[model samples]
Target: MSDELDLLRAADPAPAGEGPWRDRPLDARAERGLNRLLHSRRTRRAGRRLMLRAEAAVLALFAVLAFTFSDAGSSPAVAAPVALVVHDAAPPLSLDALARSAEARARTAGAADGPHRGSHLQSWYMSMESGPDAAPPVTVPEERITRWNADGSGSELVVATDPRHPGRPVIHDDHGRWRTVSDGKVLHRKSYPAGSAAQHGGLTARTKPPTDPEALRAHLAQLYGGADGTSTTPQLLLALSSFRQEWTPGPRETAAIVRMLADADGLRPAGTVIDRLGRRGQAYVYDDPDGPDGASDATRQMVILDPRSGQLLGLEITFTKDQPDFKITAGEVMSYEAWLP
Candidate 1:
């Protein structure tokens, strides 16, 4: 086995005796509910839920993870680190206004063609266990780079590192135990052979997303494949996030996405703020009163868009209320994705 896999195998996810929360009791029903929510494909695709399968105490939370690459090391280099910018209390900019501005900008921009060939992303993902033998939540910070050539060849690289705190130990799941590993570890790296059509991007079967606002909406709903033939606000956000993973939408597609989001229920503009990448963007939020599972809503979903180009800069999911069962505090981030151009 490779050194990285060997190290991963040596670590455990639930190290014994980490804290008091580890010994807390959870009934089977709640445990199953939490598990069902966390591992569901829709939620998992957006990094909206923690991937850990241990118990009911788990909730995905956020942290800012930044990385800087060095030419001297075997670890691959990446763009700058990700910084979590707190939502500002600026005047609300209506989604309608933002959408109009985006449409206007798209009209004036030069024509662009074809689906995006790759993506650059930085994110922080968390997994926690609350019951006996459970360890405190482990936050994993990663930088991923993907590229696809016209010939259908592509490569994917994922590295575990947080340059914001150089040399700090990174905790990872080593089997069932939580263990600390060195920073700058290359967790996964692979390249697709040329002329391989099986690894293409965009929605299933189709390689490009429609640019018409209604078409885009239906496109997303169809990809969702729910019984009602429609997507929830959370599901739409997750769908867009998944699309972004494979393709970076150009001005036309971006404008359509902005318009589509404007029409989504409960999403409202909050104000203008500088994104983590040091770009100014309009912020919109959706705080559903009823959580996805129909319980009291405990999370808020936020999307940031570049006002000038109307492109998405990032998406954040955060705790809106404290969950005593999961030991999560209000305002704690659940997960975040910073998409790079």
Candidate 2:
């Protein structure tokens, strides 16, 4: 029993005493909701399997219970949904304006033209696996750094850490055991020899990207590898993200990327916001309701750029609707990547 409790502690996503509601007792409505959830057909089936794995079962139960009673503490439901307030008063910056400014900044900075050889980034991404034995869906946060030397050798390092919550236990799955570890725990580290670093499917790694805005747009689509007859917005965003993973864009390349995005259809300026790395950036968004040509998922994609230099800052994808089978909720972030300058 002691060992079991320790495992539960390690797998707890939210440790006790963290949130305002942690100390508050559940209201009557919330208690009733929890009872219904525990006895539901799906819960019973899951509970049978969960009995074999106390940690995963409890983790899944907590996730569902939290969502079920999230609004229980608030006032009773009303006829209409409440409207959210936007505090920022400044108007959203237009894509065209951002493109022009980025180009000007690139030229003024006289940055080298082309992709840089490395990147340092922090990321949080949802990992979901489905099966009788699969663990619950989880979002993992970590920091990754990759560097390449002039001799073509490079190294990669990944650490489990969330900068926003320093010293907090970082959750990770080791084999089938969901556990927590101290921040900065080294998850992976490796060094590569010359010629090995260039082995990637990235567009920029294959060929030099043109600075011409129209040409770059076409280049992105040509290399996107999406099915024909589908919207390129989703594919382009993925390709752009892959580009960031392989290489950081230089000033000239940054300017071209901005200009190319400016002309892409369906993307609109989405006001400024602070990225996960604490840098303020201009945001642009594209919503894909039916997903790519044949896909059925609905998701929102966003690209954040440094407002001053127009360099790419971050990329995010989020689900806009609930997926009950997968234990996903609306407005849940699917993935986020913040590239450092």
Candidate achieving the largest TM-score? 1
Q: Can you give the TM-score per candidate against the true fold?
A: 0.69, 0.68
| Count of clashing residue pairs in every prediction | 14, 0
Q: Write the per-residue lDDT of candidate 2 for residues 240-263, one digit (tens) a residue.
A: 665566577777788888887887
Worst 10 residues of 2 by lDDT: 76-85
Once fitted onto the true fold, the runs of candidate 2 whose alpha carbons sit more than 4 angstroms away are 1-88, 109-114, 130-135, 194-206, 222-224, 227-230, 292-294
Error of 2 at 175 (Å): 2.5
How accurate locally, in lDDT, is each candidate? 0.57, 0.60
TM-score of 2: 0.68
